[model samples]
Target: MSDSMVPRKPPSKGFAKKKKNIILLSMLAPGAIWLILLRYLPMFGIVIAFQKFTIYTKNPTLLNNIIHSDWVGFKNFGFLFTTSDSWKMIRNTVGYNALWIVLGTVIAVSFAIMLSLLTKKFVAKAYQTLMFFPYFLSWVVASYFLMAFLDPTYGLINHLQKQWGIEATQWYFVSKPWPILLTVAYLWKNIGYSTVLYLAAITGIDTSQYEAASIDGANKKQQIRYITIPHLKTMIIILFIMSVGRIVNSDFGLFYQVPQNNGPLFPATQVLDTYVYRAFMATNNPGMSTAASLLQNVVGFFCVITANSIVRRIDEESSLF
Candidate 1:
């Protein structure tokens, strides 16, 4: 065929564009559907917070119940705040979470920095694997493991006490030691995950900074303080801001199961989550539970906003938003 008369292939711009769009949509489909179903869809149920919800009615469908239920403005919330245990629940919840956020950050960051500085890769990986083992453990399993140490008659603690000629203590019945115990448990379960995060951040740091610091005669401590810590500050602040959002929400299993639901330890252990669970189980009033949940969400939302605002003011780069 003559050179000018040869057939040329059609352009593929449109087909390529369409194929790219399809691939993007396919990749996003699962996550988009998940968010719609699990996150956005449940937001509609927040209306039930204001309604006195009943599970069994002549018409038991969700829409029917929502429409038929009586609206009680803020009364459900008032119920949560009016009881004598209200202050106790708030105190325990906020107190324990505040402690966890602070201690968890410090311990996790310290561990990550130390681990990253390890001379041997195999030793560091082994230690990391051992530490991370607890993060996968269910809180129920962790509670039983804790019981093995705190069990009144035959626990390791009591066994040691007996060996030392000290009287065996009823650990579950006592509230004094629980704050420490719960903090320990929280650290043990969570430190591994947080360490992994911080360690990942640490690994991303530019090694040139350390090399320059070394050239400047900065010691390990000096280099860490000036370089490594500054590099991690952003991640630390971001995580702290997120943690603040959950300040009102207690770990239900940690507060409920860890103490074995001992009534005597309620003063130390009962937080907003456990309180709401107990109240719902006792009264079957979804309204009150929903109100509590709604309040927590609202508070958490504001907390994130406030934390981000504060971070923005101090260090704009570190703000979550």
Candidate 2:
């Protein structure tokens, strides 16, 4: 046999590397397009916030010629902050979001922990499906459902009160009960996703660790406290850190639509998102909405930075960075 006739490996065909590149590019293309169209492209509109936008103006440049449309740097932001509604919106946003984070984490973690303990796969799957169903519903749909139960006249709550010989209550227009209602609605709608996330994290834990804990005569609660929670610490910290970013942004539909936009509920229901919507409605200023959104992003960025720093200080492993 001639040495020249011997077969060689043919340089791996470089298929693996080429395939990886193709896969990465494919994955990135959709997201890149989405960000450009929906997220990044709209950033050009930020200039509107600086300009005195008017409907009569065909374009900002043309309006600048007819009117003294000069840059009012920080003036809109100043108006936002100086208004009486500013403090109220900020307070409502922070309060509701804080409550949501704490309660949501607790309920989701507890549900996930309980689910992990269930031996029956079918039962667990059924529970998960039922929980997830609500998450799929749009806020508009959920608002209608909420109103059916809470409406002042024909609502179930009012009907029940009447049946019990009590005066039927007007709840939709009231500010007092909204904090609790909003929190409950948020939990009901959001718990499924968080539960699924925590469950996935739990499943990733090594079974050998649990067996060893069992051998050590650890009770279920002890196993959970020592093993499960410690394993989840990093995920918990990461999710909480993410939640901090949205502390200023409320669930707009929940605050706006659920209360049916009745003015009486403004004190309790108004948050930065809803307040911005109302402002935009009155003045037809997209700039104010943009400004509000930009402010939210700025605050969220600082909050995330601060939160991650604190997390890193306490536990470097748990820090998102």
Angstrom error of the Cα, residue 244, model 2: value is 0.5
Q: What is the per-residue lDDT of model 1 for residues 1-321, given as tens digits with 9 covering 90 to 100?
A: 799999899869999899999999999999999999999998989988988986647879998888888898888898788889999999999999999999999999999999999999999999999999999998899999999998988799999999999999999988989999999999999899999999999999999989998998999999889998999999999999999999999889889888999999998899999999999999999999999999998999999999999999998988999
Question: Which residue pairs collide in model 2, if any?
Answer: none
lDDT of 2: 0.87
* Model 2 C-alpha lDDT per residue in residues 1-321, reported as the tens digit of each score: 898989886656588789889999999999899989999876777776776666445555644532555567777676588787888888989998998899999999999999999999999999999988899988899998987898778789998999999987789666898888888888889999999999999999999999999999999999999999999999999999999999988888888777888899899988989888888899886667877888899999999999999999988989999
Candidate lDDT values, in order: 0.93, 0.87
Best by TM-score: 1
Query: In model 1, which runs have C-alpha deviations exceeding 4 angstroms?
Result: 1-18
Q: What is the TM-score of each candidate against the true structure?
A: 0.95, 0.90
Error of 1 at 261 (Å): 0.2
Q: TM-score of model 2 relative to the true fold?
A: 0.90
Give me the candidate number with maximum lDDT.
Answer: 1
lDDT of 1: 0.93
- Candidate 2 C-alpha error for residue 268, in Å: 0.6
